[model samples]
Target: MNIRTMPVVAVLAFAASCSAFAADSIKIGVSGPYTGGSSPMGASMRDGVRLAAAEINAKGGILGRKIELVERDDQAQNDRGVQVAQELINKEHVVATVGYINTGVSLASQRFYEEARIPVINNVSTGSLVTKQFLPPEFPDNYIFRNAANDTIQSAMIVREAIDVNKYTKVAILADSTNYGQLGREDLEKALAAKNIKPVAVEKFNVKDVDMTAQLLKAKEAGAQAILTYAIGPELAQIANGMEKLGWKVPMIGSWTLSMANFIDNAGKNGEGARMPQTFIQEPNTPKRKAFIAAYQQAYNPPNGRIPSPVSAAQGYDSMYILAAAIKQAGDTDGVKIRQALENLQEKVDGVVTTYDHPYTHDDHEAITMNMVVMGQVKDGHVVYANAADKANAVREKASGKAKK
Candidate 1:
C-alpha cells in the first residue's frame, strides 16, 4: 500500500508514536507576546531561549532528558496571558516556564505557577512586583525569579541620567495606562522626589495610541526640558512622532523598553538619541557576548545583523542558562527542588549578560543589579552605549563589587 494512502488506524498509530516520543523530553513553557506590538522584545527573547536550549540539548541534554519548549503567544493581553499560563501548567505539564516580556502579562500570569509550585524564570519582564508577588510572609516559598533589571533600578537610573547627567531640571513623566506603566510612573515619581524634584507635567496614554499631541502639549507648556517615558515601543514611537510633528525636540529618557526595535524603527529619525538603561548592548565587548551574538546571528538572521532587542535577547539567553544550572543542581525536575536550587545556585553561570555568582537568595530574587546596567542610546538604527564615562563607571563598580565578594 502507498504511504500516502495509509489506513486511518495506521495514521493514528504514527501520530501516537510521535506524541509519546515528545513526552519523554523535558517540557519548558515559553509564553510571551509573539504576534503583537510587543513582538520585538518577545520574539527576541524567545529566539534567545531557543538558542540556549539548542546548545544545552546538543551537549547530551540537561539531566539526560532533551529540552523541549512549549511556546504560547499571550498577545500582550492580560486575560490571554492567564489562559496561557493555566494551559502551560495544566495541559502542557511544563516542569518550568520562561519568557514574560510584558509586565502586565507577567503580573497576571505568574500566579498560576506560584499556586502550582512550578518554577518560572521571568527573562524580560521588568516589573518591580513580578517576583515579589509571592514572598515569605505571604507564601512559604516564592516560585518566580527574574533575571532582568527591575523597574526600580531602571527608574532610578533614568532619573539620574535626566537630572544629573543631562542637567534637565524640569522633566515630564509620560506613562501608559497598563499596570506596568502606571507602577513604573510611580517609581519614577518617587525617584524624582528623592532628589527633591517634581515633574512639570505628568501624563498618561493608552497602548496603541497613535497621537501624543495632548501629552506633548502639556509637557511643552510646562517648559519641560526632557520627557521620561514608561510605555512600550509602539506607543513610544508615537510619542517621538508627535514630538516631531509639534516641532518640539527634547531628550527621551525612559525605561529599557525604549531600546525595542519597534520604537527605533517606527520613530525613524525622531527616535535617534533616545536613551535608556540597558543590561546588555550587542557590541561584543566580552568573549562570551561575542560568541552569543555570533550564535544568534547564525541561528536567526536579524535585520542588519542586530539581535532586535539586545537587552531582551541577552536576558533571555542568560535566564535559560541559569534555569539549566538550577535544574542540573536539583538533579530532578521537581518544582520545589528547582526553586531551592535557584535560590542558592552553587556554581558560577557564565552567561551572555554577566557572570552570575550567587545572584539570588531567600530574600532577593533580582539577578541583575544596578551596577551591571549601563546607559544605552538609539543611534543610527541601533542601540549603543550613551557615553563612555557611564559605561566605564558601571564596569568599574561591577568589578569592584566582584573583587569584594
Candidate 2:
C-alpha cells in the first residue's frame, strides 16, 4: 500500500509513534502576548502552562490521554488574538484553549470562540466588562471562563480592607483609561458607595502616559490619606515613583495587577509597603507551590532566561488544568460541551495560586473571587504577606459576605 493510502489510525500512530504517546494524545491551545509591552506576563503564562502539561504527562496523563499544547502568540492585540483563536479552533483542532491574559486580547477573541463553540479558560484577564458585555444573547454558551478574580470582587475586597481594616478615610482614586482600569474604578465606586464613603480626589490618566506627578500632587493637595489605583505594571510603578518624588506618603491599595514581579523591581524601594491583592504568593512554600517555583526557576535560569512574573506562570498553569478538566468532563472534546462543562465544574483543583473550589459556574464566569484574594506587601523586592492578622480578617470578610456564599 502507498504511504499516502495508510489508514487514519496508522497515520496518527506514525505521527505520534516516535514519541511513544500515541494512544493518549490530546491537543490543547494557549494564546497570549508572547511579544509586546506585556510580553513579560505572556511569556510567564506560557511557561506555567507548559510546566503543567509536562507534569500532567509525567503522571501518566489525564484519563489515559497525554496533553499537547498548541501555543499561539497574540502579541497583546485583541484582533490578533481573535485570528489566532480561530486558527487554533479550525486548523489545529484543539480540544480546548487557554490564555490571552490581557483583557483586550481576551475580549477581542471571546466572541470568536463563542461562535466556533470553542471553550476558553482565561488565565489573567480581569476586566469586568468581559463578564458583562459577552453574556447570554451575546454568547449563549458563555464560552468565556477565567482563572483570575473579577474586578468587582477584587474591588469590593480592596474597599473593605482600606476602610474597615486600614481605617483609611480619604482615599484618592487614580485610574488609567483602559477596560481593566475603567471596570475596576466603576466597581470601586459602587463598593465605596455601599459603605457610604466617597473618594477625596479622582484622577485619570492614559496607560501610556509617563508623568503622574500632577495627579499625585492633586491628591496630596486634596488631603488624600490613601491611594487606590487601577493601572498596569509600568504605569503603576511610575505612579509610585512620582508619589515618592513629590514627598507624598500614603497607604496604597489596588488591583492584583500590581503584585506582578515587574511592578516591584521597576518601582524600586518606593514600591515597598505597597499593598496589593494576589491570587498566588511565592513564599512560605507549600510542597505544591515550592515544586512549581523550583521547576520554573530551573526552566528559566542559567542556560535558560529568567521569567518576568511567576504569578502569570501560575495563572497559565491553573488555567490549563481547568480547561483539561472541562474537556475530560465533556468526554467528546467538542467545544460547546467542554464550555458547558467548564460552566458547571464542581471538583476542586489545587492550582499553583490556591485551591480553587467550583472554579466556574453559569451565572458567574469569574472563577477566582474575593475569598481567594490575599493581601501582600512588597518587602525586600519580594511579595510578602501584609500583617497576617489583617490578611485573615480580609479573607474572613470575603467569606462571610457575598464572595464565598
lDDT of 1 at 14: 30
Total clashes in model 1, counting residue pairs 3 or more apart in sequence or in different chains: 0
Per-residue lDDT value at 208 in model 1: 82
lDDT assessment of candidate 2: 0.74
lDDT tens digits, residues 1-405, model 2? 211132334323332442454544787888888775577788888878876776666565666787777778998776788899889888877777888777777777877777777777788788877756567775565777777777777888789889988888889999988766777898898989999999988888986688999899989998988899888788888889888888877877998767766677789888888887777776525666666676666555512233476668888988877777777777767777787788777666777776666666787777765666777787877777876754443322113234544
**Candidate 2 vs. truth: CA RMSD?**
7.0
Off by over 4 Å in 1: 1-21, 389-405
Model 1, residue 129: distance off in Å is: 0.9
The digit string of per-residue lDDT tens for model 1 on 293-341 reads 8777766678899878888888887888899999999999999999999
Total clashing pairs for each candidate: 0, 0
In angstroms, give how far residue 364 of model 1 lies from its true place.
1.0
**Using Cα atoms with residue i matched to residue i, what is each candidate's TM-score against the true structure?**
0.92, 0.85
Residue-pair clashes, model 2? 0
